[model samples]
Target: MPRERVIFLVDVQSFFASIEKTADRSLQHKPIVVAGDPERRSGVILAACPLAKQWGIETAEALWEAQQKCPGVTVVKPHMQKYIEISVQLTAIMESFSDLVEPYSIDEQFIDLTPTLHLFGGSPYQAARLLQHKIQQEIGVYARIGIGPNKVLAKMACDNFAKKNKEGIAHISYDTLPATLWPLPVRSLFGVGSRMSRHLERMGIRTIGQLAQTPVERLRKKWGINGERLWLTANGIDESPVSPRSHDEQKAIGHHMTLPRDYETLEQIKVILLELSEEVGRRARRKGYVGDTVSVGVRGARFDLPTGFHRQTKLTEKTNDGLDVFKAAFDLFCTHWDGEPIRSAGVALSGLEPDHCRQLSLFNFETTLKKERLSKAVDHIKNKYGAAAILRAASLTAAGQARDRAQKIGGHYK
Candidate 1:
């Protein structure tokens, strides 16, 4: 008989908030929230502890609203470096259980234990309980694990059932699909978002059981290939491999910043664009790649009527130099900008190629050489001294947040 494929999806509950509680024992059994910036009461909540959930506190809502929900709730800021270190440790632990481990996010991971169960007491459920216990003992946080025959089922079980149970573990298989999975609302399915659920409801499919029974032809006629994928998923069918290397391949390197204050002027916006471009260039060079396309994204400052702009430009000569990327991104921004007050902006470099190989352009030969040399010097200084060692003249202006960002990991405080 073929080996049964057993996948485990594990999630760290209220990750940032839980980390805060772990860091300080006083926060235990209290309603706590993680906010981007407490002073900005309008800032979005990143995470809310289980106690906070009782008052209907939610992530991505304004902190002020969360305060309204629970007047006594405590708000904490994120510590990205600590979270990242813990995530590294968690990944190491998961790899001990199975070599086929993939980190879906900092707080979520998937591990396939089908072929490796014999190494760990010959039971996947036993392994999950052991793993969850280990995380609690080592990291001082709660973790829930869901076991299933595939990634989708594992994730669904983790989110829908395991997360709510006291034991923090749940299992689902082809055998229990009807009893455990089908009765849930169709929106509870992994691929079905709110908008998709509304559309499915229009077609008289309110539950996963209904969706599974609906004709594949009917769904495909409405949604094309996506409908086929959903039909398979609703029926507990997924054939995708649990490949570990899938996340390592890079399609783009980008950096974005949420400005402390709205950037209303051209000079202010231009400075941030240059800073983001430099960061993107440094990362691409570190990865030993050059890119031919540069893209820019701008989010408007209007809170109620939120809108953003995105545009990209292709370069004749591929380069990873910071100045080169800034020039391209700046041009795109100037061309496509609606001149609206901006709340956030980002720069991305894509269509990557190995930095070691390059084709020269006849039109701008000496200019490109100078830019490459200058960018190399900047990267060298920053890497040796610190990211703050080298900053453009524009960054010295009042609009600059470069100095603040240098001390952060992923734009959150260290």
Candidate 2:
């Protein structure tokens, strides 16, 4: 018989806000939130501490709404670089407990402790407690841990039970699913959100147990492989491994920006599109990859109605040149745009291959070689000085966002 797998999904409580509290002891007990600059049109709550949560402040809510809820809420601008550094440090700490550690996100990670459980305390709970304590002691932040036989149950355990339980540790298994997880609403399942829960409820599967009891064939016929996967997850069956290199595999490189105001003209929209294309190209080059597919996405300024288009086109040859990407992206935009006042635009490159594998252009061989060398030189200068060190003439235009974006990470101040 095979040994039951012991997996843990560890989540840092109010990661960004907690880090802010830890860095400033004066705000340790005060209601606080990490938010973007109000002047930049990114004035939304990114993370809120427990005290803030008590005031009904939530992530993704407008900062003004949070302020209305709690007049004295201490708002701290996000330090993305600091958060990333601490996340890396946290990952290093988890690696000490087990070799099979995978980062699910900046604030969540999965660790398979099947083999190391005995080394820690000979029991799953004992090991989890120790790990939790170590994180608090070293990082000055609280962690909620969910233990299970697989990743899905572990994630659900953390989100549904551990975070709410007093001890901040919860365990779930196939044996416990009927008694513990099945009684909850179907929406509480890891993969089931509001939209999916509605679909399941319409099928008379209002609880996880109901979903688990429904025929897999019925779900498979409806949602194809996804429905079957949901059913398996409801049954607490997940065979995925915790691999450390999960994020190293890149499928695409993309960048998106929400404009300060609506851009109504094609020229203005194209300016932002070109800036996005440059960023996409720079990132791809930094990673030593080239791509053949360019995608353009645009969203309208109207919030009351749905509006936007995401389209992609394949080039004859893969290239990481900014101008090349912009040409393709611009063509796509011109072909599909509906002439709405745009609020945001994005550019992406996919169908990736290593730069070394790129075939020389048959017609523009010399020009291509020169462009590649020039791009490398520019990349080198930017890396040594800063991202804003070298810029295209278009980036100096009022419509360009590259300058402002260079000062940010993930659309927030670094």
Top candidate by lDDT: 2
Candidate 1, residue 73: CA error in Å?
Answer: 1.2
* Cα lDDT, model 1, residue 56: 100
Structural RMSD, model 2 = 3.1
Clash pairs (backbone) in predicted model 2: none
**Which pairs of residues collide in candidate 1?**
none
- Put down candidate 2 lDDT per residue, 1-414, tens digits, no spaces: 588899999999999999999999999889999989888878999999999999999899999999999999999999999999999989999999998999999999999999888899889899999999999999999999999999999999999999999999999988888999999999998888799999988988999999999999999999999999999999999899999888767899999988988999998888998889988999999888999999999999999977899999999999999989999999999999888899988999999988899888789999999998998899999889888998888788888888888888887788
The CA lDDT at 200 in model 1 is: 94
Pairing residues by index, what is the TM-score of model 2?
0.87
> Per-model C-alpha lDDT, please?
0.89, 0.92
TM-score of each: 0.87, 0.87
| Residue 263 alpha-carbon offset, candidate 2, angstroms | 4.0
Q: Every model's Cα RMSD, please? A: 3.2, 3.1
